[model samples]
Target: MKRTNCKIAFNDKLLMLFAIPLLSFIIPIVFFGCRLNRQPYFNVARFFSTFIIIVLLWMVNRYILIWCRKRYPRFSDVRKRLLIQISTMLLVTLLGNNLLHYILTETIFTENPVSVFDTDHLITSNAAAMFCLIMIIGIYESIYFMHELRSSVQETENLKRENLAAQLNALRTQVNPHFLFNNLNTLISLIPENPDHAVDFVQQLSKVYRHILEVKDEKSIPLKDELDVLHAYTFLMKTRFDKNLEVNVDVPAEKLQKRIVPLSLQILMENAIKHNIVSSDKPLQINVFTDNGSLVVSNNLQMKKQVNESTGIGLNNIRNRYKMLSDAPVKVTESETNFTVSIPLIEQ
Candidate 1:
């Protein structure tokens, strides 16, 4: 609803300097046949009149173009902007031509006046007006289309950079000393209690880091691949929380090939554990599955009585990443008993 500066990326001043006079000279000959063997070799009066009309039309249409661009600056509004610009220009061209003829014939030439109603004059004049209108509009539209295309590409790149930053921040949080110490304690305890599982735990921990490094630069990954990595990350969390945190993944085999944003499930898993109560007394349950054409993550709402405030960086990161890949939204639904997040899946 706000407005941007009314500027087109094109500079038409020099263009108009050459184009207006050229159109002025050519329109008369193109629409109404010219005779070379006339008294005054060239009709300076007619040329001057046509030149004035062409200049008037050009100025009006140019202003309309700038106004429309300012009013609807977004790429999404291009259709509406073009519709308004062209319709308004066409009306102005027709009316302005008629008005200019009226001024020249009725106001200036009294005795030997031109017939403004002559069918030949009407047809030629209207045809010439349309020719100039289309030529000018075509030039403006072509430049605008290219500018918008470039702008869209730049915006997408900016989003990608921000998404990458968010991912890096999440990565830092994971490898922070606190996380390493907790996992180290778990591994130490496991070595004496169950040496085989300790070996499995170390392997899973490596898999989690390896998965993160693999997908850190990826856009979308197959659901099967994501789930494999997700299980690895969950294994590490399960080692820390034991039976207090439970994650169930239930995607059909056929749907495993469908794709999603990289590391989405793990972020949701972490989010569930962070805000909710995950203890022996009140275990947290997080479910991952496919619904319709989307991947869903839902967790029961056994919230902590006093927890650090949520910044929503995790969910927002996935959302921004998804926007670059698809128009489908990352949906979040919250109820008294549970919280749900649904991410649309992409075809392989």
Candidate 2:
């Protein structure tokens, strides 16, 4: 951190190489021109002394400004940090002005031994210098703010990309070769014994895939659409397991109109099935309902002796997408008898 402070302010190298040194030379020439003399004349000694003081003063304020920026980088912290910065700059400016006055008094009076007392002229020049530097500080702050805003936006975009990738991976798992092989095996058995049921199974499987493709590009969709797709997906699942799997969706019609991340319910259902045992003796039960402004998904605890391979992104992907979309949270909890997920249903 100490080494960081020694670097050029805000990583803008031109500030040190150009702006500060150039201003140091120009400020005194423009403000204190010939005030010590009754007539206009160049005072090399006075110019050099004032330039050094201005350079030191500007550097100190610049350091303080950068330090304050680092300590309070967020936009919410802007007011508190700006107050600290401005107050510190005020103190530095006053002390610098006194040093400048003393240097000018020594160098100019020595150069011209018969000059009259011109304290008022010198004091007025110092006041103007202070105000001008404050304006310069304001300009630097604007640049810092713009840079911070850009960085924040970039971070959000990166998170969105990650969320989409996770969603794609979950979809891929649904349509992967192993899942296709098992369902096709079931279809082959059903076709000979129950042709009509086999046809319905094929249609439901197609609906599941169609819904996945349709919602791939969407950030979120109505819970109504999600449940429509969930029913299609569950049809395929129940055909595979028969009485071994039971899913109860009890959400109110009004709750279905709310929005959720695309395919969120499907992902949660997949997670529950992968981790739990589904058998004739101890059938798996999954419940979907609305509770306290959230969409609740829960399942009974019936752990499998050997769990299937998982991508581990289902819940995390929903959470990340919701963070980008709303202030609401996705909550997960596990107890002695059940595992539950409560996802906020967004209103806006």
Candidate 3:
């Protein structure tokens, strides 16, 4: 990266040297109708001497600014870095003007020393040169900043898309046959003892799967739609834990129209159960409520001593999905006795 930046800086210097001098010569000949067309040698020598000095000043200013930016990056330390930049530019402009004035008076236009060194002539020439040179540097920096901004925006968008795809893949894994197999075994056990409840279980299971499939293309869904999906998921969990797992949702009717990342509640609930001991002796109680335009999911912590290994994909998926869907974060609060997550309820 350092080597590439050095190469770019070298190319920019070359481009400025060639382009600025060529334009300087052409503008007078084409637009101003200066007799530079008749006295090509004098005109060429004058412009060439002046541009050579300006280019040197530009190269020095560029190097100094690059060093300042590296030491105090604009994004991290904007005020200090900009102060250093302006000071450096002024110093370079002063030195460059003095150098140009000396060259014109001593060598290039020696026949007119009085005009070159006269107070008014010196002030006008120095001011014009400083303004033009600084403008060149300013334009270059502006273009570079614009390019960087565009690249940063594009990279952020790409990362958002990639994370969204990862969330989808994780959701797909959750809905795959391995997950179905466990529930299938539970259903098999229930069918022989309670045939009617097994039918209801199968129906809810189908609804849960359908909801997952339907939300694949959606970034956010109404809270009520998510609640319906959560109800279907709760039915499946109830089959396994029965009285050991209790879930209560207490959201008001007015908040139902608010939006959230789909399946976020289900993911949080599952995360709570996966890490907790759910048994008749120590039941896991999960509560879903709304507070200050936020959906809060809290569960009593009864951490299991032994359980199946956890992959932690669900919570991460929910967090990543929330990041893409809204600027508000999925806030988590944990303690020795409870784990809570608050998701910002987006207005539809």
Candidate 4:
């Protein structure tokens, strides 16, 4: 899952607000009541009273923090919030101490049981101090949790980006090797009858490599630049197949100025050739045009029964690359007699 900075903070704040008060109230009452031999009723009353106070404090503190966050332009600072929590805890502890001192001195059960605190008539004051201490501990835990959440989110995002880049690079590696092997075979087949065309093939192959190298690190290239490479590629295939291959291009001149994923057209062309049989008797017809906001490549399928070792990587690579750039998935359609791929055109 992709994690954003703001989302982590938001989640952490919510979890902290709910979890801390419950833990603080439950843990101390259970452990300290047993150790001090307090009656169950007394322990239960003390727990409920403390719980209510803690809940009130949590609400007030959260409201103040949220208000500060909205009012101040830079209230996102974790350090400042931590300081505020510490200061609030100290202030609450001092106020509670004074209020509890008065309550313990003037209230019932002052003389029957021993003073809860070391000093006479200061038991409530001592309880108040303990409450403040628990609050301070909760605040520290919340801060720690928030920090850890931030770090985890950042690391996850970094890993996701790196994985995406690696996959893209792997796809690129397959393309160059696949293209080279096919073009080399074409050159070999033409060597005996047309030595001149074979020489031209070698030059075209070099130009293709040069173009690939130029845009190897680029995420996308201008449509015109991609078309120039596509034309060079088709020229090589046409030289080898001659009249056996029929190609048509009908893109709007204005759209050629836009940007597209590099080698997108090349991938579609290769897929068409790999799946279909092309010869003088049955020439393969491939068409390129635009519909709506997409560049469409369609080919009449005269499929060969015995297909080559197809890894199904070309279409997958193109689809993944486009996904990174656009919201729409690259559209693919296959029928008994035709195959079409529609790729979204991106503005520069």
- lDDT winner among the candidates? 1
Candidate 1, pairs of clashing residues: none
TM-score winner between 1 and 3, please give it: 1
Candidate 1 ranges with C-alpha deviation above 4 Å: 5-118, 305-313
Candidate 3, residue 214: lDDT: 85
Residue-level lDDT of model 1, residues 210-261, one tens digit each, is: 8888888888899998999899989999989989888999999999989888
lDDT of 3 by residue, 82-135 (tens): 788778888777877687668766876665354544776566556665666667
The segments of candidate 4 whose C-alpha lies over 4 angstroms from its true place after superposition are: 1-196
Candidate 4: lDDT of 262?
A: 83
**If ranked by TM-score, best first, what sequence of candidates would result?**
1, 2, 3, 4
Per-model TM-score, in order, reads 0.68, 0.63, 0.61, 0.52
Clashing pairs in 2: none
Backbone clashes for every candidate come to: 0, 0, 0, 0
- lDDT score, candidate 1: 0.85
Candidate 4 residues 179-263, lDDT tens each?
Answer: 6687778888889978998888888777776887777677789999988888888998897678999889998899998888887
- Stronger candidate by TM-score (2 vs 3): 2
User: lDDT of all the models against the reference?
Assistant: 0.85, 0.79, 0.75, 0.67
- Could you tell which candidate, 2 or 4, scores higher by TM-score? 2
